[model samples]
Target: MADTLRHYGPAAVAWVLLAYRVSKGRRGAPDPARDTVWLVLLGLSLSLTLLTPAVYAFTGRVSGVPNLARLLGHGSMLVVAWSARTFLWHLNHPITEVQPRTRLHLGFLAATFAAMSVLFVLADTPVDDARFAARYAGDPWVLEYWLVYIAYLTPAFASMAVLGWAYAHMSTAPLLRVGLRLVAIGAFLAIGYNLHKALVFASERFGFSYPPAGHLLIDGVLPMLAHLLVLIGATLPAWGRLVNAPESLAWLSRYRTYQALRPLWRALYAASPHIALTPASPALVELVTVRDLNLRLYRRVIEIRDGRLALMPYLDLDTATAARARAAQAGLSGQALDAAAEAAALHAALHAKALGATAVFGPASHTPGGGDLDSDTVFLRDVARAFHRLERQSHHG
Candidate 1:
């Protein structure tokens, strides 16, 4: 299970991130940070894919070079690290400041890549080994190659962790902050993976045997987990624009508000059937039905307002005043106090109407205090909640 997860997990995450980025890019103007993120994601996808056992074996066999996939995987990881650093630099600094640093960073990366390639060529790895590090543990050139790879990665990952955390704190956007934090955590995890591999390589070089299970943790589990975090972090900021578009969230809010108003609406509808433009559906039918949600919600809100108007004659002012006092005493304030009082008055009015009581006061004039549909919906939802709570308390009493 661990092996399966390690082989597929990072690759899956990387591909998903890449696909999301591509989809998002088609809708917006080109952004440097987004483009940089795409490069980092692409590199991660390639590295993870190449490092998978099946792909690793195929690459080695096809190329007629032993463990060539290891070099390609390491090289792709180098690109991921470099691209990530570049993304951070572009995000936090002016273009003029970043340009000089970018050139220097690219130069260093090229030199590191060249050195690793030389070391890999010199290493006497004549046979393809999926467990390349463990198999070549004691080989001097292979050890140097591993050390050089670790040397490039350690500071890169450490700096990324520090920068990501710092930027996360500075960011005002909620999703961006969360994404940066995840990236920081992933970078920290990658550092741990690097240290673990370094320790394993050094232990083998010094004639000390490291635990075999440590290899699985270091190679598969740790990297998979780190890659997942980083991939999620990279894509999270776009989720609002992509997955949870404003229209979608608005629809969801309307659906919830519509549902929440059900108890209060049903009570009013039972008292005065004429208030509804259309007959009420059975509760189970209504629960399963979601066609034309906006229209349904609008109609429900209007019918609720009409029902409240119809019940106005039975709304005793004394009952409302008493309910408000009790609600205040019970630590309800603001909207809670208002909703509780409204619910109590409505409850009294419903009971009076049920008992065939004549209007004591000629239609007491009251309108729910909201200028617009959304605000009215919000106030009505609160009233509905309070009404439900009152019903529960009444039943218990």
Candidate 2:
């Protein structure tokens, strides 16, 4: 009610700490870009932490929200520095998709600092004492608050749009998809708040020069809203929903990721079924070249019940025809054709092993090393379902 520590601040602080400590991820090598993101959020939280008390001192006179804004700009300087350090970290090492985007974010951060610096310079310099005292003493860098909000808005939208565009290409677990979407929703809320703040400052006419019925929304209402955001972004990980999410969702941007690897799979079978439908984004190449050329992708998914990735080799039609003709010729001379047949069978066996399949079907003359294809794609799905059934069955037993 009065915005006291026990009321909401401690919970907010705990959440901030959780995000700070836990967002390094459960069991993976550090992602510096991801690390940078956490640091910026943490730094912002610290700034808010310091600024909150300062605002409490000025409570009845100046607005807490604007104070939060000033603190955000100050805090954001740390974030911007951290973000740039992240870019250098990436450049020194390597992270594919995030590198260029981080650069773009750096540019936005630069603009934010430039704008805030200019506003401060204009308000504080001796060139204009009257305006300096009038503006800087009371609400200096008022525009800095809005500009920083706008700068953050840049990445907020970019991340959403880019992630949404890239959502389809991911190969990950299911809960992860939900986590990414949740983060995106949180991002959208953040975007809304900044945009609202920008609009609030659009005209002094709406009551900057006068007074509202009770209190201004930006000055009075939004500080708590900002606190809620920090709380949400920070606390999301502790929720059981998010704890289970990173397994799948970190890969699920708004854009799907499954498709980018499709062509590689298709090269093996030539007839790859499109089961998972999703959005498309720019093709990002894996940094290292995959050198295995003999890789055959029957392009199959395994679900649990039954899987049919049966692979077998077939001789080229011309080679088969030539071999058969030669065999016929040898047969007339009373020479055995068993050698040619044995060679073809051995070839098929090699194919089955390479595809990681246990079974092979079809005639030596027709389909070569291919196997029983239920074609309806029930194979992969059934295999997955059957495994779950067996687990249940075993557990019950």
Candidate 3:
């Protein structure tokens, strides 16, 4: 089960991220070419996962090529290496100027892929045996095939280690630095994995016996752990914004509070347009700063309180008492009762004010105010909801 999870977990994550990118369209990447490379990496990882023992068994039977899974895995790894290297190159270099060495790197990758393909085709190995790497370790053809695979892989992993480490230190952004550091670490782990596999096969060919415990750690555990780290590192920049700036989430909440308060504000603003001190811009676009959002929301809360204070002069104690009784009968309690009673009072006051009712002098009760802005926002939102419900109920009556 652990092995299955190790094999499939990264694959599942890769495909999900790929689907998310595709659905989001251009939002996923600033550069289309670079985005395409990332997508290809995701696709290759997903494909390699599906080409595992269970699925490949069926595929092999249908294709009449017993050792087809090895070829598929090799091909997928090659593509992933190419894509990752290209991605890093683009990331490191300025977007305006294409790197001169890019074409040469592409040629090298293409040559590597071609050579691996040729060797796999030429090599004779068992068709149905899933343990192709271990079973054919001593075979001359298998050794050549392994060498071809590792030759490109070793260099690719090493380059990633160097590039990732250098860029991580050079980067100013906290999230980017951390992500690149992870990538560097993962790349080194991958290098270790490749080296271990090479040594295992070489030992078998050279009649040198090595400990099984060390082999298991190098071959079995390392690859899965390395791939998981690499995937996380590669995708970290995309998600780091959410992780780094918790204030962004707070801003979002404030914006939502502003929206929820809209109906109440509009009603109050209609009654007292002078209450608005500042010109309102698009809440989402203009309120980019946390301070701005907080200020805007604060002004809105003040304006609402002012409107409530103004309406209080026209509030009749008899009407409030009757409404409170009716609300109680309607199953309102605590905050809900307070909100309902206030809504009823406000609706009556607005109507009475429209008809110019004489000001009534009575003992005044204050709006609940003790908690921070978040609590205030929630309380006011409930009041607004109750206000709307009262208006709807009155209209239908």
Candidate 4:
């Protein structure tokens, strides 16, 4: 169980990251097909990682089917090699590049996989041997299997390492450079995995016992460590960006709200600057600090509401109803429609106040839109958008 966890835990993490990257949808990235190919590579790596334990437990049943797990594992690795080759080619070249060479590479890999599958089915082997690779080391078909499989994977990882290092050197973006460097490092480690396998094959062919250190580290440690590093490297860019995005976006959103509410706040403060509990600074400076911006926005909303209160008697309901109808006709609805109505009401009230019109009703006669400070700021942004139109219409009447 511990061995299974050690091997498959990062595979599960790789699967999760693959799902998230897929969900985010690619836009503006170079070579969208490369993205899909890399996804397939990781997905197959994860599937094969998961199958390790199952293959161990059911070696008899698996070997009975000419060792279906081993055959599928080889096929999976071949597909990964093909995918990596295509992705690396796409990464380095433009869309105008000829694809025949790419197709040939994939076709050759598929052919190899097909030949190996046929060989595995035909080869005689002990059905109950749990350690198939070591137990069948003397078999010619099995020896060819190891050689051909590694022949494909060794160069694939070596090319990936080379491409990753080259791209890392060329890239100016900090995060991209970091991601590429990690990929190169991980791929470099994976080369050792292939090398260890080659050494195992040499030991079997030449009839020399592998060193105890090689037996322990190569078979038990190298592949898991290599896979974990590769998974981490693959996920690093998305993980870093997603970690930083929300705070950055939130700060930008608050500042945009502060700016959007500016027109209405400025107009109301001009009419009734004395209504503010504290003397205010210039709008630009007030909006710079995120912590202070919330308070500043709240104050602006309150002062605008106060100024409206002082000019309530001058508000003509008939004119407001007509203005709302016009705004609705112009496609404003929901809170935006209400906001336009509020703007129209306030514009009429401000004009009447300027002409020294007296109050006709008490505060008890007024109706308020039931809203708190946050919703008020949002509503007021829409009101600000409609303010100029409301002013023009009121003057025309």
Query: Best by TM-score, which number?
Result: 1
Model number with the top lDDT: 1
RMSD of each: 10.0, 17.4, 18.8, 18.7
Q: Candidate 1 or 2, higher TM-score? A: 1
Q: Provide the global lDDT of candidate 3 against the true structure.
A: 0.72
Per-model lDDT? 0.85, 0.42, 0.72, 0.68
What TM-score does candidate 2 get on C-alpha atoms? 0.42
Q: Which portions of model 3 miss their true places by more than 4 Å?
A: 28-37, 95-99, 242-397
Off by over 4 Å in 1: 26-29, 209-215, 240-397
Candidate 4 lDDT (Cα, whole model)?
0.68
Q: Write the per-residue lDDT of candidate 2 for residues 32-77, one digit (tens) a residue.
A: 7445546645655554554454443353134423333343435453
Estimate, for each residue in 1-397, the C-alpha lDDT of model 1 and write its tens digit. Answer: 8668768777977888798778766546766676788888899999989888899999999999989999999999898888888888888898789889878878888988999999999999998988887688778787788789878888888888999999988987667777888988999999988888777778878878774665664676777789888888877877656666556646766888889999999999999999898899888888888899989998998999999989888999888889999999999998778888999999999989999999776644565546798788888999999999988898999
**What lDDT does candidate 3 reach at residue 163?**
87
Q: Look at candidate 1 and tell me the lDDT of residue 308.
A: 91
Which has the better lDDT: candidate 1, or candidate 2?
A: 1
